[model samples]
Target chain A: MRVRAQMSMLFHLDKCIGCHTCSVACKNLWTDRRGAEYMWWNNVETRPGTGYPTGWEDQDHYEGGWKPDGDGITLRLQGKGKALARLFFNPALPQLEDYYEPFTHRYEDLFDAPAGDVQPTAVPISMVTGEPMNVDGGPNWDDDLGGSDIFARNDVALDGVDQTIRAQMEEIERVVFNYLPRICNHCLNPACVAACPSGAIYKRGEDGVVLVDENQCRAWRMCVAACPYKKVYYNWSTGKSEKCILCFPRMETGQAPACAHSCVGRIRYMGVLLYDADRIPEAAAVSDAELVDAQLDMILDPNDPVVIAAAHEAGIGDDWLDAARRSPLWKFVKEWGLALPLHPEFRTLAMMFYIPPLSPLVASVERELYRLELPPERQDFELFDRLDKARLPIRYLANLFSVGDEQVIERVLRRMLAVRVYKRRQSVEGVVDDATKDLLASVDMTPEEAEAIYALTTLPTVDERFVLPPYHREMSIETLNDPLAHKGEVGVGYLEPPRRGW
Target chain B: MSDTVAMIVFVAFPYAALTLAIVVTVLRWKLAPFTVSSISSQLLESRKLFWGSIPFHWGIVLILLGHLATLFFPATVAWWNGVPIRLYALEITGLALALWAAAGLLVLLYRRLTTARIRAVTTPMDLVVLIVLAVQIASGIWMAVGYRFGSFWSVGVVVPYVWSLLKLSPRPELLQPFPFILQLHVVSFFVLVAIFPFTRLVHLITLPLPYLARPWQRVVRMRHIEPVG
Candidate 1:
């Protein structure tokens, strides 16, 4: 067996405070430099507003990545139709101005320019040029998504549809409007990975968190162009590109990721989820809806000795084992069907899972359907604005969280299944108590359903394997003194020294 | 006063310019936020820009290598070291690669110039760099044709004299024997260098790996709550 260890993350949208502490922490730690001014590896974009750099999702406008025309693929760019056409051809869609213009200060105005005009005591100037005036915005502008106009317009539910599933769609829209946090699904099959030409991007062997190689990144910004979600950022100064790293370094130490750790809402959950790497290709080949089967197969029993032994043998630590014992990843996934993959469509099997928001609209519609004694089959189903036609809109729900899963189209009138979005009520340190499952079962489901939910949500298998090589097997802060001890350097981590006088 | 002083400035100045270019390039590469940071949600989500940029850079790097080699080659290597067969092969191959690279550069340059966002970011300095590079490549090929070429001895003298000065030797004999055409080329090179630090040519100083490193963290943001925009 290839024996690939898989890892995943879950962000409770309800708990996210959007303080951007994570962004700043990331910036301070990594991207606080010249060319990187344009890049935000941990940027928190307000939806409904054209994200910074604007219309990033509209690939047709920018001409990035491959577009599947039925089954055939065509490059989205212009002019290179067949031959080496012209010396200068136009891109169908051009790159956008994602960052504000860099500004400088004017220091001369203080004592030199005006010359004895009361000689202003203090020179009010910008930083770059040091002149005596203020520069408008040189990158990192209006931090709060510019203003509230963008926020007021954040609700997509207001956009009424013309389809027969109008009422249900409206309901679905209402719930999403209430609160639906969307994140990188970290798909099991990331389209972004498939689209990269340089092979610079890869999903981690242990956690399955996809990453782009900075050294290999020729600043082509193709990843920027291809990701439908527009997650990647290009660094103009560094002559390369960047994106979110799921914080494997921190994870290795048994600490949650920066975002998860700093998340004030405490809605984030970090855990080791055992997945069958062998079944990935097979799962990726299945229809979007049937993808659930592939994901389910990857699930391992945490308590199983064979898996435990394998995990320990793989170099998993005690902290990780303990976390697995208490992880809600097991409870939500294997025990309950509530926690679901964001989007199964784009084919990137994202590791991030969401507890579908069952909107009041869905409840109301279900009640009405039950009252009428009519079977809610596909033929009679009202094509709700967001819900899937079958059980619910899992596919469409997936798109809300991922890039290309067409399964979202199959979902018809779906909405948020859980209320209290962005609230971090779940505990990462405590194991799920059986009494809670019994209580939930008594109120919401039959004994069998409750047990199934419990089984899915409880951490069944703990993977203690270290996907990191032996050199990384046991490391400490002291190891930094011996540069060679830092094994990441041998791999893609051997970053080029910064250019002189930088 | 000897013409050596002028020659010294002429030859020595371009290296300074090259240094400045190296600095800016390095700073841009090393300290830039995007290079060291994890992949941005914006970049990863866009598929097309990602791929288009790859070919664009390939064209750029190849062209740059060809240009660097042509501009800095030793005269002995150009003439006396006398591998007629190798020289002929190199010249032909280099010229072909240069042309291909130039074609790609033109495409990329055109993309930047025409794109609204890119154009906005592009300063006069950027345009100057492009124009200068274009001219250098064009003139290089023109001179490569073996007609009206600067003398090898002149190039040989000026290049070494300049190097000696950089090494703090300030040798005058290196410049005493060079031709006027070579002097003009040396002067032009200095002018290019004097302006290099102030332009985008500064990207050279950055070490390739750190300049290109990507973070592995995957991020998902709340719908309405973008990170303070």
Candidate 2:
């Protein structure tokens, strides 16, 4: 086993409140620059709606990610030979129109306009051309508008759901949506890295953080087409590709990424995970239905003596292994099986996992003549069967997380339901119901296990949420320059301003 | 006075261009590695570029290969030319490639001038390089058409002169008898080499050569981390 420790994340979607605080924090920290005005490194996308850059998930148009060939996978964008052929001009590249024309309100007009009968208004001007433009779209134009026919109905994720079910989802009263905050997955097998003609994008081996070497990027924009998640963005002004760096400078100093630290909902969990590096290809090569299990299998138990020996042999330090043991991501993803990688069918072996949100119980209809109120004893029994009747179809959640496998979604949701029911019983006296017991029994989860899951999910402290591994900066720096010389200068921004042109 | 002018054009000017090209290219590479790119505006407008770029690149590459073979492999060219059919085929192929490249360059120049998006990104150096390349190609085609058999004759006249320059020996007398088109082609070629490092032509040196054999995935580690002994 080629044990490698990768810093991973688990975003509990059930806890996300759809606040764009993470987006703003990441923007202020990283992308608030001349060329990167439109970039949102951490964006909170409201699911059941078209996401940022509008319909990014529609790979049929964008042609991002990997497609399974005969046995292995190939990039949906282009191969090595084809990449060179299209190096001069990438026809598949998304234009500035695909992403809205970045604009700013001309607030000067409000103050400087000549005296008039009506109050002067600020008009929007294009950031690119600096001309007055009609304000039409933004990064999150369809935020929380799940019932809208324009944006939400066009969500490509809903394509896998049955046509009838999709229509039902779009109904005004029946509309249900959850917030899906995204950052770069820093995937184990990043297609962006594979498709880069300049070999500019690469995953850091020490912590598995993917970074674009700005100096090396030739602005081919193939990374924009290759990333299944569309996390990479082209800086039109700089003529280079830019992406989420995972706030590695902050990470090195034992701090969570800007987005995760500033998250209002406390949905983000960061930690170390030790996995078999040799299994990455095998894990990603599995059939879509088995992808989740295959990826989970790659994550070795940190406490296992054999694994620990292999990890030490592979040059992973003791501190990282200790961090992996306390990792909430490990507990939520592998141990409890609550969190799952998004769109495993993309086969990038994405490191970020999401705990699918639990929707409200599905309501039932009864004829006036046959309708009867549920008795107190039967009420508890009816609650146990609510999983099959959830307002959000199992098929829909499965399509998003489990690669169209309903069984996986059902298991995670059941466990979450059991924990909620168990917590209620603990908090309120005489609230203990036979249905709650049956729900826990069906999931084969003990009361202690349910309470443990509840504690970690609902009441996790900041330290528990983010188990930061020790970054050996001294060792890393010693290879290039003297660590002592650069000891005082440890932060994100460049020491000198970046020059613009050749 | 004529001999001095010939020496300046044939020896001093060529040497100066070569020196400037080498020194500036190295300096630019060291100082501004990030900016050394073709800065392809393909993202802005690709349709015209698709029609122009492919034929232009292939035509120029084949033509350059033919020029290099004639310059460095004269014995092989002479033997091939001994066969009359092979000589005709070579001349025809070279002329076709030159015409193809000229056509492609014209289309590119039109795109650069007419397309607003491309025109916006076009720097003065970009225009100069394009014009110089066009002039050089036109002069070459003129030489091929007027002189009829430059592929064989270039070995006798241009190769010896080029060899003399490499050996740091002045041989302006040998090239002075050549036609104005041939001399203009030689001057323009050296001028192109001089401006190459300063322009988008720097991308020519930065081709991802290892990409042909590189693995699908790349894992970059901190340099300090080494395998446990």
Q: Candidates' DockQ values?
A: 0.06, 0.40
Docking class of 1: incorrect
**Model 2: per-residue lDDT, tens digit, A63-176?**
888888878888998888998877766777876666676789899999999999999999998776577888788888888897679987887777667777777777766788
Model 2 residue pairs with clashes: none
Q: In candidate 2, which residue ranges exceed 4 Å CA deviation?
A: A116-119, A362-384, A429-431, A478-484, A488-497, B78-96, B110-122, B141-152, B223-229
Q: What is the TM-score (0 to 1) of candidate 1?
A: 0.54
**Candidate 2 lDDT (Cα, 0 to 1):** 0.83
Residue B213 in model 1: shift from native, Å? 20
TM-scores, one per candidate: 0.54, 0.91
Give the best candidate by TM-score.
Answer: 2
> How far off is each candidate at the interface, as Cα RMSD in Å?
13.4, 3.4
Compared with the true structure, what per-residue lDDT tens digits does model 2 show for residues B1-229?
2898998998899999999999999987787777776676665666788788767887888999998998889989989998889999999999999999888898899999987656656789888988999999999999889998988888889998988998998698988987889999999999998888888888888777677689988898765244333
